[model samples]
Structures are given as C-alpha cells and as structure tokens.
Target: MRTSYKNITGLGSAHKGVGHFIKQRVSAIALLILVPLFLFQFLASFTTGYSGVMAWLGSPFGAAVTFLIVSAMVVHMRLGLQIAIEDYFGGAIRTVALLLNSFIALMLWLIALYALIKISFGG
Candidate 1:
C-alpha cells in the first residue's frame, strides 16, 4: 500500500478546490452568454442615440439583464484574482490581497448595481 503526504499530514486544499473550480467555471459560462448579449444590446442601443439607450436601460428587462451581467462579471473577476493572489502570495500579504480583492469587487459591483437601479428608476 502507498500513502501520500497529504494523507499522512492531513493538510490539503482545505476544502477550497472543487467548489471554487465550479464557481469559476459557472461564472465564466455566464459571462460568455451575457457579454455578447450585452454588446449586441449596447451596440443596437447606440444606433438609436442617447435617449433611446436610456429608455431601454430604464426598462425592467434591460435593467435586469444588465444587473445579471455585472453580477457575473464581478464574481468571475473576484474569483480569478483570488486564484492569482493565492498562488503568488502567502501569509499576511495573501490575507491583505484577498481582503482587498473582495472589497474592490464588492464596491464595483455595488456601484454598478446602484447605477442600474438609478437608470431603471429614471433617477
């Protein structure tokens, strides 16, 4: 019988493997679908001019889709950054980097959501 170091030490991924991988992939797939839709909608809206664009954003469907796109993008970005930070950093620096990454992602996501809400409400 062969025993690995991980089994001997009981030190492994600390439960941050499969779930992280799944979440990252799911977010990526969501972005793949949402980005093109967003681009087409944005480009089409551009042809109609500013007011038309605003009108579309102000609509329920537009706001909802935009929100979804932003949410997925933020999630994907945060997870990707987290992986990079974890791989390259350690100890205090890793903690700081992770905290900063999450904070920045949350801030940006909130800002985007707020803008979407404002546009949806015509405010």
Candidate 2:
C-alpha cells in the first residue's frame, strides 16, 4: 500500500484496531453507566420535588458529573448517528442529515453546559 499523510484512523485502517476497539467498548460501557445514573437521579428528584432536583443538579460534583455525562453522550450520539446517516441516507440527503445532526448535537451540548453552569453558579 502507498504511504500517505492521512492517519490510519482517518483512512479507517485496521492497524490501530486494538485501541479503537477499546475506546469503542469503553464508551459503550460509559453509556450503560450514565443512563441508569441519570434516570435514578431523576427518580430521586421525583421523590424530593423541583427544588431538590435543582439542588442536586446545582451541587458542585453534580454539575461536574453532569458535564461529563453530556460530553460522553454527545460523543456517543455523534458516532451512532454518523453510522445511521451513512447507512440510511444518500447523496444530498445524507449530507443534509449529517449537518443537521451535527447542529442538533452542538445545540444540545451547549444547552447542557449552560444548565450546568447556571445551577453550579446558583443562577
């Protein structure tokens, strides 16, 4: 094969298969952890009501973890949707779909970050 400036990951080569698989599996594991953690948090909120929910969200560690959750979720969503778009859509529609997904993802991440900051700062 001819050598080029492009990285293996960029060219989608199998050379770095081990690291890629590890990262993919770790992210999947994180999703499993984050999902139930978030749901449990919300259920606890249901027990305590709005202010309790806010307080939990507003706590220092809570905010930090929330940020991490958002970051991981966005990464996971991007990966999932990328494959979906590539597999399902074609031509201009594929491009549009990918662009739309990217925009939506960024918006969601920003919203989560904003909420985290607001609660963390007691706003």
Candidate 3:
C-alpha cells in the first residue's frame, strides 16, 4: 500500500468539497429560476406607481419570493467567492480573503433583508 504525501501530511481532500460543489450547483439553479421571476415582477411593477409597487411588495407571495431570491443570491455569491479565494490564495492571505468575503456577504444579506422587511411592512 502506498500513501500519498497529502495523506501522510493530513492534508488530503477536505472531505467537504463535494458539499460545496453541490451547494454551488443548487444555488446556481435557484438563481436561474429566481432571477427571471424577480425580473418579471420588478418590470411589471414599474408601470405602477410607488403605492402600487409597495402594495405588490407587501403581498405575502411577493414578500416570500423576494426573500427567497435575496437569500439565495447572497448564499450563491458567498459560496462562489469562497471557492475563488480558496483556489487562488494561501495562508494568511487566504484567511483574510475568506473573512472579508464572508463579512461582505453578511452585510449584503442584512441590507437586503432590511429592505425586504421594510417593503413588506410598508415602512
């Protein structure tokens, strides 16, 4: 039996790469569907005035779908960035990049959620 350097050094595959791959694929598919739906809704609302747009966003279905799209988008963005950083970076630089990636994603998510909530509540 032969042991590769990776195995010997306990640096073999993370055993979770497949999970990240699967998540990225799933998120991509989700975005594919959600983006069209969102665009349709958004463009449709443009013909309406501010009150009408607010009304549309306040609807339960609209709120839910918007939330879904935002959440999926943030997740997809984060996962993609994480993969790119991991592939192109190393050591402390990698750590900082990943952390910054996550922070940016988190901030975007929070901002999105805040807007969604405000719209949904007519605030």
Candidate 4:
C-alpha cells in the first residue's frame, strides 16, 4: 500500500538521493585544487608574452592541466546553474532552463577544448 503510493507519485522516496549534490561537491573540490595551479601558470605566462603562453599550453603537461581545469569548471557551472533553475522555475520554464543550461555548458567546454587542442598542435 505505501509502496504503491510512492511509486505512483514519485515522492517520499530516497531514490537517487544526493547524487547531484555529491557530484557538485566533488567538482567544486577539483576546482579548488586546480584553480591555484592555473593562476600560477597564467600569471607567469604574462611575463613571457603571447608566444610563451602558447608554448606552455602546447606542452603535454600544460595542456592536460588546462583541460582538467576547464572540464571541472564546466561541470561545476552546469550543476550549480541547474540547481538554481530547478529551484526557481517550474513546468515548461524549468524544462527550458535546464536544456539551455546543459547546452551552454556543452558549448563552453567544447570551445575551450578545441582551442586547447589547436594550440597544443601548433594550429
């Protein structure tokens, strides 16, 4: 009886509980570690100018770090925005907002990855 009601309404359940929360927290942790590494490299790149910056990005280690930073950053952004949209919006608006949030995050990640790969390969 109780189980049937829960299945019908999709409420009073612990199914998939805190999965999104855990993911967001994990991504935040990754960014906390990666941001300082990025800042240090970025700041030092300023001294050497454009070519130097490109060179750093072109290297394997630099490219990998930058990739990780961008990946984590985008995931965190998407998760955060998703929570906001889900909390504030409803019905069609919530659906649309969620879709847009995902699309924007995907685009940002793709653009950054493309540029990073291009620079790494001297293109």
Candidate 5:
C-alpha cells in the first residue's frame, strides 16, 4: 500500500471538525425555527405597550423561548466566526480573533439572559 503525500502530511482530518460542523448545522436549524417565532412575537407585541411586553416575558414559556433563541444564536455566531478566523488568519492573529469572538458571544449571551431575567421578574 502506498500513502499519498497529502495523507502523509496529516492535513486531512482535524477530528473535531465534524463536531463543529454538526453543531453549526443544528444551531442553524434551531435559529430557523426560533427566529420566526420571535419575529411574530415581536410584531404581535407592537401594540401591547411596555407593560404588556413585560408581562409576556414574565411567562415561563416566553422566557424559555427567548433564552433558547439567544443561546442558539450566540453559539451559531461563535462557531461560524471561529471557522472563518481559523481559515483566514494564522498564529497570534487567529488566536486573538478566536478569543475576541468568544468573548463577544459570551457578553451578548449574558446581556440577553440578564434582560430576560429582569423582565421575567418585573425588574
């Protein structure tokens, strides 16, 4: 048996790539479903005023859905950005970009979750 140069170079599989790929796809599907629900809720709440919106958020179902959408969106964004950074950048730049991407995602998620909790608790 003869091994090709590409195979011998060990550049074929990253092993963890599949996990990232699957997570990206799953998050995409989740966003696809959740986004429409969010938009509809947003549009429907337009005439409800601030109190109405707050009350809606206070519901268990509303809070859960809001959390799900934000969580999935952040995860999807982080994974996509990481892939782009890995593919285009190198060395310290890639590491820095990945770190920044993760930090931004985490911040966004935390902010969103905080808002949801505050609204749910009437704060």
Candidate 6:
C-alpha cells in the first residue's frame, strides 16, 4: 500500500524531499571531517612554501584525499543551492537558479579534478 501527504502546496508526498536533506547532512558531516585537515594543510603549505606544498600534494595519498574532499564539497553545494531555490524561488527564478547551480557545480568539479590530477601526476 502507498500513502501520500499533502505539502504546503498540496501536490505530492514529502518523502521525496527527505533524501535531499539527508544528502546535504551527509556532506556537512564530511566537510566537518575535512575542514580541519584542509586548514592544517593550508597552514602547512604556508609554512613549507610552494615547493613543499606541491610536494605534499604530489603524494599519492594526498592526491586521493584531495579529490574526495573536493568532489564531496561540490555535491554538497548543489544539494544546498537546490533546496534554497526550490524553497524560495518560483517560476522563471527557479529555472535560473537551477541553471546557475549546474554551472557552478560543473566549474567546481572541473577545477578540482584538474588540481587533483596535477597533484597526482607531478605538475
């Protein structure tokens, strides 16, 4: 059997929306784990200078973690912005918001991927 709950707009079940929230929360937790590591790395970069920083990033393990952290960040941003758009914007604004979100997400992914590769491949 199936049941439905009326949203404020009274259109469909609310359960569909829960995954969005869950995904966002998962990303948030991931970020919480990454933030300290990222900050510490950034601080170390300053201490060690460019060559040292690049050397650290150039490591296989460093490259892998960087890729994972950046990818998760982009996914997190998408979910958050999607929720905001759907919550407040309507009609054309919502469409525009979605387009912008997609663009930003892709940009982040590309930049992060490039950085990860450069770090992994030695330059």
TM-scores of the candidates in the order shown: 0.83, 0.77, 0.80, 0.85, 0.82, 0.78
Query: Order of candidates by lDDT, top first?
Result: 4, 1, 5, 3, 6, 2
Error of 6 at 104 (Å): 1.3
Poorest stretch of ten by lDDT in candidate 2 = 5-14
Whole-model lDDT for model 2 versus the true structure?
A: 0.78
The per-residue C-alpha lDDT of model 3 at residue 116 equals 79
Is candidate 4 or 6 superior in TM-score? Answer: 4
RMSD (Cα, Å) of candidate 4? 3.5
* Per-model tally of clashing residue pairs: 0, 0, 0, 0, 0, 0
lDDT of 5 by residue, 27-79 (tens): 99999999999888867765799877777677898788889999999999999
Report residue 62 deviation for candidate 5 (angstroms): 1.5
- lDDT tens digits, residues 1-123, model 4? 255755766543766556788889999999999999998998988699988999889989889889999999999999999989989999999999999999999999999999998998767
Pairs of residues at least 3 apart in sequence or in different chains that clash in candidate 1: none
Instruction: Please list all clashing residue pairs in model 5, or write none if there are none.
Output: none
Query: For residues 88-109, could you state the per-residue lDDT of candidate 2 as single tens digits?
Result: 8899999999999889989999
Overall lDDT per candidate, in order of appearance: 0.88, 0.78, 0.86, 0.90, 0.87, 0.81
Q: Model 4 lDDT vs. the true structure?
A: 0.90
TM-score of 5: 0.82
Model 3 lDDT per residue over 1-123, tens place? 898766666545764435777888898999899999989998898789897778778888788778889889999999999988999999999999999999999999899889879887667
